[model samples]
Structure formats: C-alpha cells, structure tokens
Target: MIDRDTVRHVARLSRLRLSDEEQETMREELSGILEHIEHIQSLDLDDVPITTHVVEVENVLGEDVPHEELSVEEALREAPEVAGGGFSVPRMG
Candidate 1:
C-alpha cells in the first residue's frame, strides 16, 4: 500500500518538488501499481519458464571476411595532425 508519506519521501529523495495535487496523484498511481504487482504475484506459474525475452532471438550478422589493411599514410590522410607516422590526438587528463 503506497501512501502519501511514501510518495513525499520518494520525491524528497529524488530531489523533486511535487505540488499537493501531484503528490496525491502519485500516491494513487503508486498504490495502483503495487496492487497490480500483487495481483500478478497471486497467479499460479509453477510450470512457467523464466525467460529474459518473450521472443526467441538469433544473431543476424553475416560471417566476417578478411580485408586488406590500410597503410599508415592512407589512415592518417584526413587527420588534423600527424606525428611519428600516426595520427596525433589531443592528450587526455
């Protein structure tokens, strides 16, 4: 049973400023959500299988093929700066 105080506490924790009307609405909505969860919990699913997804999925990507490697000059052609036969990127802190 989600109450007004619980909603207000959650709002405070989330750093949200809810009006009185919004708080009341949130309380009702949260209570309804809890009720729905309780209803779902009451269902009998002893034979039901736990699954991560509802539909079966398979990798659709095609096989990888070997490709010719690019030369250092070709790779660094569009780079803003080049040093020591490679792209010179900005240093990170």
Candidate 2:
C-alpha cells in the first residue's frame, strides 16, 4: 500500500505540489490501483495464448482491378489553371 510519504515523494519527483487532503486521497487511490494490479497478476494465464486484440476479424473484399494510365492531356483537361502545359497554383508565403 502507498502511504502519504510515498505519494508526496512521487509528487515531488513529478514536479507537483499536493495539499494534505490531496496527498491522502492520492495515497488511497494509488493503493487501490496497486491492489487491482496485484489481483490481475494473480490470474492463471499459462494456457492462454497472447493476442493483440480480444476479437478476431477478417479482411473485407476490395475493388477487383487497378486504375489504368491516363494521357497527359486527359489528366490536365479539368485543371482550373495550367502553365507550360502543367497544372499551376498560386505561390504561398
């Protein structure tokens, strides 16, 4: 269990200043957190396989084919502004 002194030490290392009430509260909260972690640590997991996610998933189907090449003129035909046969935009600062 974490005590007020330990909590104060932690707060000092973290560059925090806690009041007496806050220190007591943090000590209790941290003790509870440690107890919960200890409980989780006591669980048996020898037969359990490690996994990244809890649920299994499958890949979704995508488009069957890829895009074909387009002619330069066809590609630039819809451009709002063109200079030297290439798409152009305003200069930015």
Candidate 3:
C-alpha cells in the first residue's frame, strides 16, 4: 500500500508533476496493484508442472523431402551487385 506522500516522492524521482487529486488517485492505484500481486501469490501450485510452452504442442507430420540446391550463378543473379563470383555490398569505410 502506498500513501500520498510516497506517491509524491515516487513522482518526484520519476520527474512527474501531479496534482493533489492525482496523488491520491495514484496512491489508490498503487495499493490496488500490490493487493492484486498479493492475491496471485496466495494461489497454490504444488501439483503444477513447469512448462516452457503454453499449449500441448508437437511437430506436425510432414513429408521427408529434399529441396533442389541452387547453383552459384542462379543464386547470385538476384543480388544488386556482384564481384569475384560473390555478392558485393558498399565498402564500410
């Protein structure tokens, strides 16, 4: 829970200018945020498994196919500039 003075102090540290009414409002809002965090902390999670992904996801089956490899000339044809059989760009200097 935050009081008006604490809110005002925080506002000063953050370079924020708030009216008296805004100070009171911020106090209430901060208090509510703390209360909500406390509520979340009250939950029991003893039996829950730690999961990195949200859903029960799996790699969908796909054909084991190989793609045709592109030749150097075919690959370099799309570049705006090329030199010495390689794609070229502007000099860093």
The candidate that wins on TM-score is 2
lDDT of 3 at 27: 93
Per-residue accuracy of model 3 over 15-60 as CA lDDT, tens digit each: 8999999999889999998987887677798888878888888979
Give lDDT: candidate 1, residue 78. 94
**Residue pairs with backbone atoms closer than 3 Å in model 3 (clashes):** none
Worst ten in a row by lDDT for model 3: 36-45
Q: Which stretches of candidate 3 lie over 4 Å from their true place?
A: 39-93
> Against the hidden true structure, what lDDT does model 3 obtain?
0.89
* Ranking, TM-score, top scorer first: 2, 1, 3
Estimate TM-scores for all models: 0.42, 0.43, 0.41
Clashing pairs in 2: none
Candidate 2 deviant stretches above 4 angstroms: 40-93
lDDT of 1 by residue, 17-93 (tens): 99999999999988988887887787899998988877889858966998778987899999999999987888985
Output the lDDT of residue 33, model 1.
83
Tell me, what's the RMSD of every candidate? 9.8, 13.1, 11.9
